[model samples]
Structures are given as structure tokens and as C-alpha cells.
Target: MQNLRRFILKYHFIILFILLEVISILLLANSQRFHRNRMVNTTNDVVGKVYEWSSEVGNYFRLNSANKQLAEENAMLRQQLSVVYDTTTCTYDIIKGDTLYKYIPAQVVNNSTNQVNNYIIINKGAKDGIERDMSVISTDGIVGVVTDVSRHYASIMSLLHSKSVVGVRFKNNQEIAGLKWQTNNYRYGMVEDIPTHIVLQKGDTIVTSSHSNIFPEDLMVGTVEEFYPTAVDALNKAKIRYATDFSTLRHVYVIKDLHKPELDSLKARLQ
Candidate 1:
């Protein structure tokens, strides 16, 4: 404190001169219209830049919320697509005014792609209208099926799981087959039981078949990247490039079969 006082005393004259100079400049700027306008312009420019920086920072923080909102909007839009409204399956359930399928937007809170039984956890569950056996998909293609659910979260069997299987068909010829993960390669899946007469080409898209009531018809599953004409147990198989990138999956939609209870009831009578 004593040293600061001494320094202030020593430089009092210089400080006084600097202050007077600043004051005089301000007075001159205020008195002259041209100088006053320039000062105002300079101040406005600096303030505008500061506000712009602040706005950018705020937007950066809100990016997650923005993405979630967009996902929800997309889910609503998907619900309207003709593929989801399977008119052919409309039974008495239709007389009750129930839509065939509905989409529930969800955020992936956890995921695993390396393990043999890879699974995904989403930030939605029974409370959010999600349930067991519901189908999960990303913007690009199928991701998994719901296996379990809590009030606020649900577990999904990722398509990369060894036990996971989806009924898929070639988009061109409509030849159906079973798709499953046969190896640890998360980037690829496998399709088995390709029809004897069916021939596959490079990049042939595989889509979900109506047989899998869990998913809506024609949802993209994957594409055939390579074919193995060799048979295992007298069955033909092919390597399918995964349509959904499990490693980077973040957002997904859970599909609900509105008439599932009615369908299950009818199947139970057969049993």
C-alpha cells in the first residue's frame, strides 16, 4: 500500500495530465457534430461486435436443444409418410380409428457396438409411449428393436448384436431374406437364406419386409456389398453394409404398432 501511494504521488502530475487530455477529447467530440457522429459510430461498431459474439456463444450452447427439436419434428413428419400407413393390414382395428404406426423421437443416451450382444439405451420409455418389441430406426436406416423399458428409458437390441435379426428384402426384385450380424464388424451385417433363384448386385438396397411386424414396411435396413455364393447348412449368405452407423448414432425414433394388442389377441386364439 505504501509503495502504491508513493508511486501515485510521484506520477500524480502525469496521471492528472492524462485524465485532462481524455476529458478534453471527450468534450471536443461532444461539442463538434462530426466528431460526435464518429464517436457514436465507433461505439456502435464495438457494441455490435460484442453482441454478435454473445449471440454466437448462446447459439453454441443451445445446439443440443435445437437438434432434439429437429428430431421431434422429423418424427412427426415420418408418421405421415405413406409407407407407415399400411392400408392392407387395416382390420377391425381401423374401424376403431387407430393409426397403423406412430413414431416417437428419442435421444440415444448410451450405445455399444463392439460387444457380441451390443445394445442401445434411449432417453424414452414406457412413460413416453415406448414399449418392448417396438422398432427403433435412425434417419438413414434401421438401428434396433426395443427389448426392455423403464418409466423414462428403454433398452434396444442393436442390429449389430449377434442375436439380432431383421427380415429384409431386395428393393429391386423383392426377394426376401433374413438379416443378422454374423461377425464383430459393426460396419457390416449379413443376410442369409437368399432365394436360390435370386441374384444380388453391388449396392442393392435391403429394406424391412412386412413379415417383421415390429417395423413398418419398406424401412431401409442395409445394402448388399458382397455375396457369398457358398452355402452354409445349404443356405446362401451375403455381406450387407450397415445403413446405420452405430458408432455415430445419436438420435433415433421408436415405432409403435397401434393395433399391436389386437393383433396379439388374434394370434393367441390360434395358439
Candidate 2:
């Protein structure tokens, strides 16, 4: 107590001066309208900046949850869009009967687009209703097909795979062709077996065909970039600009075809 008293006595004049300065400033601010307004504005500016900083921090933490919610919502919207069609009177309506396909939203945990057979691993698995042969798609377009699944994770055979062949048809003419990756390019793929007689314009859209149960009909695959006449006079091949940008893929939806098992069972008997 004696030491504290001595220290305070030594600095008593300095402390008194500081206190007087604070008091004078406060009194001036209260007595003058201009000073009062300036103080209020300064206080508000500091508080507003603090609030904005805190809001940015909060948003940074919410991004992952926000992404998951968006994925789930996109799945629902995609399901609704799947069977939308026009009625006899030209009114649009969803297809009758139970839902033909359901979507499961998932996030890409790992991906490789530079290899010959690019693959993606998703955060969902069998426990999440994912299964082999299910179609995977992104907001841009078709992504790949699920090839393997465990209890908590799934592997996707990306469309960039050399062996990947998706049945696609031109949006304008409905002429069918096979979409295959040539293993050399990531941005494009080859459309083989298109009839040469069918005229193709640059930027023509190619989409999935009803011929396969793996993917819904008319799902976007790519756009025709160019075409060349094949050695076989009756056929032509095309270069397509793929819809999905594999290098930046993040979220994907797995499609579950309700009747796939039944179709597989029926085909099993033939084998």
C-alpha cells in the first residue's frame, strides 16, 4: 500500500492533467452542437466498421453449410425438371406415375482431370443411397457415372475416361451418336457414328438419349465444335466442347433410376 501511494503521488500531476483533458473534451462535446454531431458521427463510423467486420467473419464460417444446402436444393429442382413435358393442348405438366429418378447431392472430395481416365470421389456412399452405374451430373451438364461405392464414399468414372461412352443425340435432329473421350483433350470429346448425311452446324447441342436407362433422356452432354467426314463415306465424326469443366468441379448429383433394377433383372435372364 505504501509503495502504491508513493507511485501515485509521483505521477499525481500527470494523472490530473489527463483526467482534466478528458473532462474538458467531454464538456466541449456536450456544450457545442457541432462537436456533439462530430462525436456521434465518429462513434457511428467505428461501430459500423466493427459490425461489418464481424458479419464478414460470420459469413466465412457459413460457406460450407451454405454449399451443402444449395446442393440439396438443386437435387430437388432437378428431380422436378426431369419429367416436365407438354400436354396435348400444349400445356406443360410433370409426367404421370411415380418419380422415375431421384437425385442425391454430393460434394467432390477428390478429383483428377489431367489423367487418361479421370475419376472423382464424392463424400457420399452406399449409406447415402449411392450405387454403381448411377449417373452423375453437375449444374453445367453430365459429369460421369458412379462405378464403385462403399459405406461412406463413392467413386466416379468421369466422362473424360477413354472407355466412357455415352449415348447422345443432336438436340435439333434427334440423330443418335456415341460420345467418347479420345484421351488427349480435357475440354473436348469425340462423337462417333453420326450419319454423314445429317448436317451439323457449329455449336449444335448434343444430349443424352432415351436409349439408355443410366441417364435421363436429353440431359446436356456438350455442343458440337466441329465435324469431319470419316474415311467411311456413310459416317462422320465430331469434336464437341464438353459442358462440364472438370478442372473446377466441386458438387455433383447422383441419379437413381427407380426401374433400373427391374431392367437389370430382365436382362439377366437373357444372359
Candidate 3:
């Protein structure tokens, strides 16, 4: 008790000075309009900063939920856009009659692009109505075709694969071409069988052909970046920068062609 009294006596003057200074500032702030306004402004600034920090923390924790919600919303939009409306009828009966394709949204569980033959694995499979030969696409463009399917997963032969050939053509004049990944480049591929007479322009967009049974007509594939003739009589081949960045691929939709089975059966009869 005696030691504590001596310590307080030594530092009491300093403590008193601090307390008095605080009191003086408080009184001045209360009496002066400028000081009171400054005090209120400081308080508001501090509170605002605290609120912002708390909001950021909350958002950080909810990121997964936000992503899942976004995926679901995109899925719904894809479904709505997949249907074709036949509006030729006089009455309102045939306005919303035909649906050409159905979409099943799935997350890319695994993906590869560096190999000669790259493939993607999606979370949806037979149980989710995913089947072999179903077209896979992202928001930007076509991804691949489903090659194999299991109960809960499906493998896609990515557009980056060497054997991957998608029937494509220019959107301007519908000049048919074949799109294939001949090199290991992930950003670009080669479009073969483009006519030499069709003056190729840089940045010309290429898209899926109308005759493609796997993908709907006019689905964007890539843009032409370069072109050169392989031989004197051969068609010109052009390098195209792929629209879909496989490295950033996350969500995808598996498209089931409604009339594909019937088309396949009819083709099989010829053989």
C-alpha cells in the first residue's frame, strides 16, 4: 500500500494533466460551433469506416453462396433462351410450341488445356440428364462435346483437343470451315477448308455452322487472326483466337439436342 501510494504521487501530475487536457477539449468542442462540428465529423468518419470494414468481412464469408446463386441464375437464363418460339400461326396457340434444346448446368470439376488432347470433367452426368455427344458450352462460346458419362460426372472433349473438330463458318457470308486444334496453343486454333477466294480479314468472327447436329446454329467459336494457303490447290487455313478461355473455365452448360436421337437413327438406316 505504501509503495502504491509513492508510485501514484510520482505520476499523479502527468495523469492530471492528461485528464484536464481531455476535459478542456470536450468543453471547447461543446461551446464552439466549429469544434463541435469537427467532433461530429470525426465521429461520423470513424463510424463509416467501421461499417465499411464490417460489410467487407461479411461479403468475404458469403462469396461461395454468391457464386452458387449466380450459377443458378445463369442456368435459368440459358434454359429460357434455349427454347425456340414458332410465331407463324395466326392464333396464339403456336407461339411457344417448339423447344429445340435443353440445357443442364454443371460446374467444371476438372479441366486440362496444356496437353495435345485436353478434356473437361463436369459435375453432371447420366443422373442429371447428361449424355454422350451432348454439346458443352459456356457463356462466351462452345466448350466441347460430351464423350463419356457416369452416374455423377461427364467428360468433355475440349475444343483444345487435337481431334476436336467443330463445323464452323463465317457469320458474314456463311462460308463453311472446319475448326480444329492442330497445335498446342490454348489461345488459338486452325480453321481448315476456308475458301481461298473468300478474302480473309483479321478479327473476322467464326461460328458454328447451321448443319451442326451437336451445336445450334451460329454459336461463336473464335475470331480469325491469321490465314495462309497450305498448297496451290488446297483451301486456305486460318488461325483463330478461341473465344472461350479454358484456363478461366468454371461453369458450363450441357446441351441435349431434342431431335438428335431421331437424326442419328435415320442416318444409321443408310449404313
Candidate 4:
């Protein structure tokens, strides 16, 4: 107790000076409008800077989610672009015709590509006019087709699966081939049955062919990464790097070709 009293006695003058300085500053700020305004502005500026910095940090953490959302939006835009009809390029004038293009935007509720027969689930169903054999695609490229459907959801056969195959062709030449993915690589596929007579180059764009009614012509699939002619046959097998990155897929658009049923029915009769 005696030591505590001695310590306070020794530093009392300095402490008193510090307290007096604080009180004098407060009095100056309260008495002078200019000083009060300056103090308030400085405090507000510091608080604002702190808030801004915190918000930036938060946004940086949420960038991945934001990018996924943007990818989904881009996919929807591409789907719309695929079906958009330009009257300037129309060769025949129509009297009273409904729009030929239709797309059903759906989110990927479930997806799997590592399996031999991979499949994807979308948040659409029979009630929404989705049916079997409908094409599914993302912003980057083709995804798959609707294989099954219920009242509120549908399943798709992803292109990444070994069992999945689609007709594809090169953009430059009309050389057509079948696009299939091996279970080994998820990012790419093999274009089989392309003849050696069709010259191919690296980075050549591949797109869906018009041979089938499942998907429309000119839908982008991927780019040619490598090509090798068969040792015995004249067919060339080209490795295609898929445009859609399967590891990060989120949203897709289901395409319903309204003329498909009529075309299929006519073909069946011919057969």
C-alpha cells in the first residue's frame, strides 16, 4: 500500500497533465464550430474507409460463387443465340408461322461424368414440355440429351460418359464424325470415323452435325487438339478438347425441336 501511494505521488503531475490535455481538446471542439466540424468529418472518413475495406474483403471471398453465376447466365445467353432467327437471312416469306426456336433453361441439380455411363439431372420435367431425346447444352458447348423425365425433373446423358455419342462435324470442312468421351479424360473426347482425306489442323472448331434431329446443326462442341490417322484403315481419329469444363458446370438449357416428332414419324413410315 505504501509503495502504491509512493508511485501515484511520483506520476500524479504527468497524469494530471494528460487528463487536462484531453479535456482542453474536448472543450475546443465543443466551443468552436470549425473544430467540431473538422473532428466529425475526420471520424466519418476513417469509419467509411474501414467499412469499404471490409466490404472489399467480403466480395473477394465470394468471387468463386459469383463466377459460377456468371457462367450460368452466359449459358442462357448462348442458348438464346442458337435459336434466334434472323429475318434478313430468311429465304422464304412466311404468312402466319410461330417461332421455330425454343429453349428451356434449367439448373444442374445433379451431375456425374466419371462413370462409364454418366448422367445429369435438371430442374425441369414433363410438365414443362421437356421430353426424351431433347438436346442439352451449356454456354461453352454441348452437354447431353434428356434421357428420362418426371413431373418436375429430368435426367440427361452427359457427353463425358463412354456410352454417350453424338454426331459432330468440323466447321471448316463438312467432315462428320461421332464424338465420344473415354472414361480417362473428362476434359476431352475422341472424334471417330473421320476419313484421312479430310485434312485437319490443331485448334479447328468442331460442331454438331445436321444428320440427326436430336440436336440442331452448328451447335459448338469443342476444338481439335490432336489428330492421328489409323494404321490400317483410312479413318482418322482426332482428339477434341471440349469447350465445356465439366468440373465447374452449373446451368444448362434444354432444347425442344418442335418439328422433331413430325420428322421422326415421317422417317419411321419411310423405313
Listed in order, each prediction's TM-score against the native is 0.65, 0.66, 0.65, 0.66
Q: Please report how far candidate 4 places residue 249 from its true position, in Å.
A: 1.1
lDDT of 4 at 208: 94
State model 2's lDDT. 0.79
- Model 4, poorest ten-residue lDDT window? 33-42
- Residue-level lDDT for 19 in candidate 2: 97
Model 4 residue 62 distance off true place after TM-score fit, in angstroms: 7.6
The lDDT per prediction is 0.77, 0.79, 0.76, 0.77
lDDT value, residue 240 of candidate 1: 97
- TM-score for candidate 3: 0.65
Candidate 4, residue 164: the lDDT equals 70
lDDT of 4 at 165: 75
Q: What does candidate 1 score on TM? A: 0.65
Among these predictions, the greatest lDDT belongs to 2
Off by over 4 Å in 4: 1-98
Q: Report how far residue 103 has shifted in candidate 3, in Å.
A: 0.8
> What's each prediction's clash count?
0, 0, 0, 0
Worst 10 residues of 2 by lDDT: 33-42
